[model samples]
Target: MNWNDLERLFSPARLGRYSAARAGDTTKAALDYTYNLQLSEAMMPMLNVLEIALRNGIHTRLSALYGREDWWETWVADTNFNWQNKEVAYAKAKLNRRHEPQTPDKIIAELTFGFWSSLFNTQFQHVLWKDLRLVFTRCPKHQRKRHNISSALNQIRDLRNRVFHHEPLLWLTPTLIQQHSVGVMVINWLEPDLAVWLNTQDRLPTKWAEWNITSD
Candidate 1:
């Protein structure tokens, strides 16, 4: 339909960025919103793979470091990174509330992306990073500083939040390309072959090249 139709369907406030950007061209705004929606949909596969890969990679490394599969059983008591204790406790508590077993894998799944990404923050560098950093198997030897990975993950997490919350990505398309690139880069660092496989499923990059929405 037209701007009025789009406004009614998506709510005018939601579509306002598109309308305002295109000189009140509601048609283009609707189209932009639709494009963002499609790109957001296309982004999921890569993100899903990345999230799983990251969590598994970390779990594996931590388990090995502690010499046990359920290292988190004593993680807070034994590890110096006490900062993450509450996050881990929260994850376990949520699982208990749902009547789910607090298994290691279950707890890992329950932990937020924020928790995983936070491990890379410099505050944890002194404690967690010493051992956890080894999880990035394919990360370049010289370029594997905590800060670099932390920055990339923080940006990717921002995009993840935006996408999950149904925020407009059209306005952030240019920077989003970099953010997604860093996401895949993180995946590559953890699993090179998996990262290569991910390219086959990722579609947003190709669509971005075709639409070049940043210009309009």
Candidate 2:
């Protein structure tokens, strides 16, 4: 699409009139670069932490509860939990296609973030939450409600999809910051030492200041 068309598509009202008014500047290339850089830098660290923490957290809990790291295989074998059947099937297919032995670590790594997040879904909440909550030790301490973990995960998943899909994020700075905090908090909840190291590695604050995005 042409510059004008691209601007119209991406420069939504959420980005403010300043962005929309400057849509033609530099033929939209500069703006696109800025948006991509800002969003990518802001989301990268959290994405890394979220994926690792989610996988490890779930693996630990399930392994303990089910008495094996390969609990996912047995969990999927049960026909009763039909709600998760499709996700489990997809995970199995991913593992099979890899031609690698289906270890719990491999399967957990292969499973999509959506699959892990879905553990909090109301359908499986009753069956899964009892065991799952034990892994998220800090969630109850901070949120005081078990459901908040799912809510945060859902929000992070949405933001992740948008960022990865090259969608506009300029308009979502506030939400992005909020969700980024959620990511850090959840990471800390999962592993304190890792979170401490992640704080040192985080680039969001520096990038935010570089972009001069007002916290208002």
Candidate 3:
């Protein structure tokens, strides 16, 4: 089922009840709730980034290359999957160093992964790898393993979708906030120089040098 379907299946009050039953103590429950909120927030930047990129026409290349017909259109006009935020338009306009004009596809890919570059190293790296795995591997929907990016993205999307659909967040998981190493690799592939930029951001670990991704 789509993310919206999942949201209606579980409600927040029902989630609270579930948590009340499963949590061992007040501290544990509080931590769980906080983690869920943090994860939801963390997932926003990427969605914002994607929407910005798409709106700006930055993702034209990948979308064209992949033969995307209506995925993007479906997204923008989607009532159930509203990924837009005002910052996205600003982000797109501000993409080029001097606001140089860019094609839609390039804009999307650059910003899609560029947002990855802006994330806290831990979450960014993991989500990047998760996307890579999803894109690279050939997995059927029936046997999808622990796909990391979707887990996090889906987690965030599902939460938002639930709220939009007038349902509560019942199935949120707390311990799923950590990165999956995909972000690091995707940054390296999409923007070779991102390694150095990440260094400047102070989000990546020192050992990140071992990856040998070029900034130029």
Largest TM-score belongs to which candidate?
1
The deviation in Å at residue 154 for candidate 2 is 0.7
Position 155, candidate 2: lDDT: 80
Ranked candidates, highest lDDT first: 1, 2, 3
Question: What is each predicted model's overall lDDT from 0 to 1?
Answer: 0.81, 0.72, 0.39
lDDT of 3 at 10: 52
What's the TM-score of every candidate structure? 0.89, 0.80, 0.32
Off-target runs (Cα >4 Å) in candidate 2 are 1-29, 77-80, 140-142, 213-216
Please report how far candidate 1 places residue 200 from its true position, in Å. 1.2
RMSD of 2: 4.2
Model 3 lDDT on a 0 to 1 scale: 0.39
Instruction: Tell me how candidate 2 scores on lDDT.
Output: 0.72
The clash tally of candidate 1 reads 0
Candidate 2 lDDT over residue span 1-216, tens digit each: 654564577664433443554554544445555655676767788788878878788888888988977776676657656656677677778878877777766767777888788888776677888888887776556573557878878888888888788665655755556768888887877777878888887887676555544322
